[model samples]
Target: MRFSVLSFLTSAAAVSAAVIPSSSSAPEKRGGSISVTPHDSYSSSIGVLGCKINTNRAAYWPSSPDCNNICVKVSANGRSVNLLKVDQSGGAHDISYDAWNYLSTGKNATEAPTAGGGLAATYEDVPMSECAHLLKDGKHLAFAAANSMNFITSCSANTWVGKNYALYNILNTQCTWGYDELCRMPDPSQGNQPICEHTLGLTVALKTCPVYNIAYPTGKLSIAV
Candidate 1:
């Protein structure tokens, strides 16, 4: 086993080069209380999804260099938006570059994302003309009453917040029918529920919420808008 100096040098160089970016281009302190310009709400017509985020919205750094998972809030023109994150390959950011860019630099986000354009753009503030999920955020924000539920062995129809909401079975993503069954619980049960992306995405608790605030019924957690 004669040692090849060239091979050894090559391996060392490659490994050393890989460590450079990690030690050099560390991501900046992400997530803070920052204000954004007052742009129109994200609409299907304009090509954005989710709630019409204003200054009152809260965001999480899901992936931030700060060990605290600590997010500092900021505003622009008195509005706040969260910065989605990017850590590994094949992530939500790849599909939602517009959102990513907006989080990166709030100045441009104030402007409209490309209308019917593809996601991702050069920071020139121009339309990509390729993005198509503009209507996605709206669906995500639409708070419709839970007509279905998961993981619930049973459920019942009740008037919550003066509206009708369904309590259903727990449906974790173990099986298709199980998930479906969980979404449509017409009875009541005690257990974990299979909550889907759409369910979590839409916290329609306000439209049909619980009647009493057991947390601090006597003091705080009062049932009020």
Candidate 2:
């Protein structure tokens, strides 16, 4: 069996709130002014989360507080909607499906028209045994198997959405659908093809572990998972 480059972020650490960077060149204040209940949240300082800002409804968790921190307010069918910032796990580069929906369906957003009706942007589970390595005590075993996550955080909504292996080398196809603007993320969401390879996110997890002093504790990982 072959592995990928992107391992897993095993080690744990004390992280502070970070923001993504926004555009330096302003959009040249246009003509008329607009109001928004659910507005598009834009900011100049964005970290860890990248340059994208959350819309009225795209954000989740502490990142969001009510109808604030939105990206853009879209105008659809005479009604308005707010675009929040939700995230995609592996693609780490693009926005989540839910966030995509919220942003496009708002009066606060750019009103990117719906499906030609007019044109709308559109946007999972697996087994437990298959995901055993990812568990510690019926939960994400970040500490048990991977031994980096410290095994405390909650698991993603569903499992088995996809699977990947870690290796020093990756195929181009692996990253065909993804796009990487930084050294961190290098693949596209749709990746290239059977020949195109990429470093999987799992690889990144393990790689970052050592930096955080989280070496894999032999017998700690499991394939039965």
**Candidate maximizing lDDT:** 1
> lDDT tens string, model 2, 1-225?
011212122111211122222222222121122211211121111111111112113322222111112233334334433332322122121222223333446421223322111123221112334333322122221111121111111112221111211112211111211222122212567443122134322232122112111011111112110
Model 1 lDDT on a 0 to 1 scale: 0.22
- TM-score for each model: 0.20, 0.19
Off by over 4 Å in 1: 1-97, 103-182, 189-225
The best candidate in terms of TM-score: 1
lDDT (10s digit) by residue, model 1, range 1-225: 001112212322322222111212222333323222211111111101122222112222122112111123333333333331111111111212233334444533324332222222222111111111221222222111122221011112221111222222211111111112223222346434334434532322332222111111111222212
lDDT of 2: 0.22
Model 2 TM-score relative to the real fold: 0.19
